[model samples]
Target: MIRRTFPILGVLTAVLLSYGLYEALIGAPTEQSMGDVQRIFYYHAPSAWTAFLLFGINFVASVVYLIQRSIKADIIALVTAEVGVVFCTVVLVTGPIWARPVWGIWWTWDIRLTSTLVLWLIYVSYLILRRFSSSGQTPLMAAVIAIFGALDVPLVYFSIRFFRTQHPQPVIGGEGSIDPKMLQVALINWAGFLCFACLVCWSRYRLELLQREVEETEALEALLDSRKAQ
Candidate 1:
């Protein structure tokens, strides 16, 4: 089942990405103020949205893991956190690239930027704790971290509104509205990225499940060997 759907997902992601790239790069009109530089917003905004969305998933899975101690829930929380980190990486990279020409600097310590950086760091730390540390208590600790990490997503989203920042205002319901064509492009790219994220998360979750199976098999074999020797 996975083998058949996996290749199909990859192909679909490629098609979506190619079309999205063309729409963002050529179809979308240039902004009156920032000009071509504003085009980076196509990828930047979607990546941010995707990251937040994944983190939300991670939060729910984390809660389920805590309450039920289900391995499926734990796998989901782990995969979502890892995928969310990838999206956050895109946001952090593209943000500075966009800011360089607009703000005359590559980075800033504004509320929006700071909170987002912290969000990324928290998830990165969560991944390290799960991957590099010892087992058993790690999932519990990681689940707690994921729950708290997700709490920061809302703060990052509202930081621009709650505090003064060099970052641009929201594309929706802010002081100014987005151009229709640009909004369409943004939405299109967002859809593509979300699909891409799902593909990646599914692959990671399956891989982790396989890894656990292998580990359990090895442990069982070792136990049998020890009993035979005894």
Candidate 2:
């Protein structure tokens, strides 16, 4: 039953996400200041939020994997980290696209922007580390890296406070206020992206499981061949 339900849930979520995108692009009101280009916010902000959420999941799963020595937790952490990297790339790319129109530049060295760049690099390095690290060493090394890397998230969030920033503060959640119509679209976009993130993570996790099973099968076959030769 659980197996059957997942596909149905994925289809429903995809449908809602499609509707949200249409509402974001067509139904939402345009910003007076940035005009049509401002519509990118629907995608960009949600991508950033999803990246953060994925990284958080990776951190928690890493902790559990360390404590429980569960392969499932490690697989979930690995899958979430990969998904997080993809969303982080989306956020970084789309940010500049939005900024080029609004800030008159393709890139900025503002605190938030710089810190986010660093955070992306850190996670990318984490992925590379996992690739090179020995299989037996993976869980401990990955858990440590996850803990250390996640600390950057809070720094990225508060970077503007300690340093100068050309980037604008979050209008929806922070002290600044946003237009009602903009807020509505932003919220819907966020929901859509969150659901999409889960879908991607689940798919990646399943793929990892399949890959592990294949490796185990290969190992067992090699052992049996050795025994037969003896």
Candidate 3:
């Protein structure tokens, strides 16, 4: 079931993403103020949303693993954080691409931008601890850190509202209104990205499961070898 479903999901995601790219790059009308560069919104906005969504999943899995000490939950938390970080990287990269033209600067310490960088760094550190640390309690420690990192998501989201920044206002809610056509394009693009993120995340989870299984089998064999020597 997993084999059959996963490929289907991947194929569907690819198809959706193909059309979404056209919609974003060509179908959407250029913004009056920002012109063609604003088209980055189609990609940038969806990336940010998907990153937050995946991180939210990471948060839930972290909580579940902490509560049940389930290895499956740990796999979920790890993979989602990895995939979420990838999308977050996309957000960080695209933000500067968009900003360079509009803000005339490639980077700034604006509240929203700074908070997002911090968010990305926190997750990157979590991944480092998981990979490099030899602690038996790594998963538990990472889960605790994930909970705190998850708290930052809300802060990143609200930073534009809570403080003044060079970052643009929220597209979903503000005094400004998006054109109906552009809104549709954005929605379609977002759906495509959501599907794509799910596909990549599912693949990563499966790979992690296999890796974990191999490690346990190797450990078992090593134990038996020691016992025979004894």
Tens-place lDDT per residue, model 2, 24-132, is 8898988777899988888888888888888888999999988998999999899888999999999899988988877778886676677778889989999999999
What is the alpha-carbon lDDT of model 2 when measured against the actual structure?
Answer: 0.83
For model 3, give the 10-residue run with minimal summed lDDT: 166-175
Residue pairs clashing, model 1: none
Give a tens-digit lDDT track for model 1, residues 110-156: 66677778888999999998987687787898999888777766777
Query: Model 2 TM-score?
Result: 0.89
Clashes of each: 0, 0, 0
For each candidate, what TM-score against the reference?
0.88, 0.89, 0.89
Model 2 pairs whose backbones collide: none
10-49 per-residue lDDT for model 3 (tens digits):
8888888898889888888888878999988888888898
Candidate 1 residue spans exceeding 4 A from truth: 1-3, 151-175
Best of the candidates, lDDT: 1
- TM-score between candidate 1 and the true structure: 0.88
